[model samples]
Target: MRNTETIPAELSTLAACQEELVSITQCAEAGISKHAVLRLVRAGAWVRITRGVYDTNPVPVRDRICADYHDHVRRRAAWIGLLAYPDGAATGGCALALLGVGGLPSELAPEVSRPTWMDAGVRPGTVLRRYGTFPVVQRHGRDVAELVHALAQGLLTLPRDHAVAAICDALREDRICLADLGRIRSLIRGRRGVVAVRAWLELVPGRDASPSETFTRLSLIDHGVPPDGQQIVFRLGGTFLGRVDFAWILPDGRYVVLEVDGREFHSGNGMLADDATRQNGLVGTDRVIVLRFPAPRDSADGDIGGQVAERLHPLGWVPGGSIGPVVHLD
Candidate 1:
């Protein structure tokens, strides 16, 4: 038999307690018996996520194939932090997604940090991490990994491109600050993932708004003509003019703007007009040169940012620094 409609009256008193998730031990502490848990399961009020972990918000049986269902299951990993590993918390790529910065296109198996002895034994969808310092505190009412901790953890798990993307994405989204990156740099001084992440972050611009944007920025740097600024905003005295994706200031003081069409953000009629208005104001009064780069179809098409940099060469923008080249997929 399975849970059907509502929570049983005996267990109803613990409503507030089960908001995040619950465990058998937690239920016992709340004066709820195993029988009550089983009844709630039968009433369709809770869904068992792992061996002892139960999600209070059950995904309906018929809707399991939907996208939202997948997102729901991934979020259940947070409960492990709140219940099983009270001191530990979500980390790695999982925490990155929670913070709204990890630029992964698809869902990944949720990862958490816990002591070796915790022994969640055979939880299929969950990955238990035993390395690096954890025990992150809550950020938005949910137990979340600290930015540096999350970045370090993420850098270890993700490919270099994706790791850089996540860092830029988080910074651009305001999910993390540059000062915090410095703090992470110090905190993870001797950690395993520190060296690689640190080296990469040195060249990454926080002005990138998304993973693709991060890739674009890296492409420019790798091609040897990095822009002076990204997400550049223009203001005339007191009034706000507009902002562009990338900007370079020529030796003669003329400003050049480059906008990459990543296909991630598309404007409707209203937003399109607003953007046109802003761009027009800048172009008409400031005489700024604006260039747009549409995304490359595949790796063979070469880097869009590199292509943009070559165009800027004739306009008096010069490349800076002789860093090693980025691993361009193209």
Candidate 2:
């Protein structure tokens, strides 16, 4: 029979308390009894967060304690295999925790609670009502369900997509601010059901009009290109021309627009024809200098920022001050 003495010691060191239970049972042939578990709990070596659930160490604060409680509730609910609920109960503060957005006040932490049936009578604590469907993904060889739960009771609201977009948009606006990105990245990097996390990161819209536009914008921002408004509109000869994705005005009555060429915006022959007509209109007024940037995804040698700066520097638009690289907030 495997020794049971080493099991509690192993569980104490785990990063996530939920994962430690598996090791506890696996270490003994007959499995550890409730009495033994209780002994560990009474000794203060473990914490009985809820019925049949144990946290090996003291939880830091109210939020963590609540999270542990919800985790316990969810595990209990899942073990009984109840119907009408998602496979996994979402823990409180999950929405903010998962997306990595900030702005939560400290006092609000106590309000978040776990989702459970009415009869569970678990303290309402700060559990937020469910908003959307949970997406399932595999992690660490197990099926885990992903869903949003309130942080700080209902003191702070975390909407799934909006929260994600907010973080992504914030990152794009100021690449140096990465605390939120770093925090969320660390939480989800190895967690279960993080496919949604990956998809959110890859598709979340940046400040640029398109993904290609972002590539150029990043290059320019990082390489000291002059700042330009994205999607800037102008009028020529009393006719309103459509907004250009990136625009910089020159002192010589000339305007430069960096058009990051990509299939999404220029895929069909009709789009190509429309683009040509627009270029001609701008050229006729002698008011525009369109610089086409090679799609970075397709061109290995292209440097969109470098190319834009090279063309515009002679025309009087110059880079100023140092800007930092994109930072993932976590």
Candidate 3:
């Protein structure tokens, strides 16, 4: 290990802002030679992230194997792009992730963007987009597109459900209000995927608790069997039964409670017991029919939609009555 006393203040401060990462130019400016930097890498005190950038606190093996490994790597990749292209700002999903916006896809590439003239040829680990004069703000110690711009750019590439989920996450997290959606749409007005992105943006009511809930809700809506309510609390004589993921109001005044079971929050003994208790309490009301389905992994998982349609059909839900034909949000 290198001596803390020998650590240069310039390198320390620079690394502190860039996720403990610093470039070779920064090291040189701090009076460290290339030879000493190589020795630090060889001695396992630092890790070379790209050609010139190095991570002072190398990620541990335990963290590499943990559940959050992907998220950790995504953040590092964002920093890598920012450090590699100092003038480029993190954009699209990378910017959204850095801004603490949730509901992004599990896999996302590090993206950096600058003006069209500054085209840097073919970086391997990061995707570069060419743009001109978009808004920028400092986020996570790196420059990124402003929230509205980032949302528009992200929606252009994400799948319909994912785009809707991202908007839901942004609204729920208070990153943007319903009013800002108009500005986001304004930005995407003449873009390639504007039609679909506009429709997807309308799906974000922002009440769903997780990405799984967002997926399930979209699936049901796509099949023309949208839930009447979501996160609806059931109670009998003021004793709280539970807040359900989605709910349907039958014509006869009975309720259909649909629970989207996601592995993240549904696993383990404690959660299982809590789920059992909640279901029992809801059933005791005698006005609720509970349906549990594993959260849909993709658009093709239509079992939840089909089953909800089948159950509702017997209880006075006409296929084309107030709800129109399947919207088919692909």
Q: Candidate 1 lDDT, tens digit per residue, 1-330?
A: 355544445444443443346777767776767788878777777877676667676765344565444334445444544454545567877777666564543455557776454674546566777664565657445567876788877777766666777777777777678887776567557767666667876855556665666766777776776777777667675577776777777766667777766655634777667767877877776547777666433222357666776678887776552211111111
Residue 267 in candidate 2 has what lDDT? 74
RMSD of each: 7.5, 16.9, 5.7
The TM-score values for the models, in the order shown, are 0.63, 0.40, 0.80
What residue pairs are clashing in model 3?
Answer: none
Query: Which portions of model 2 miss their true places by more than 4 Å?
Result: 1-206, 298-301, 320-330
Question: Which has the better TM-score: candidate 1, or candidate 3?
Answer: 3
Residue 53 of candidate 1: its Cα lDDT?
Answer: 68
- Pick by TM-score: 1 or 2, better one: 1
Candidate 2 local lDDT, 42-144, one digit each (tens) = 6666655443344554443343445435334334333222111223333333333322333222222212222333436333232334333444333333323
Worst 10 residues of 1 by lDDT: 321-330
Q: What is the C-alpha lDDT of each candidate?
A: 0.63, 0.45, 0.75
**lDDT at 40 for candidate 3?**
85
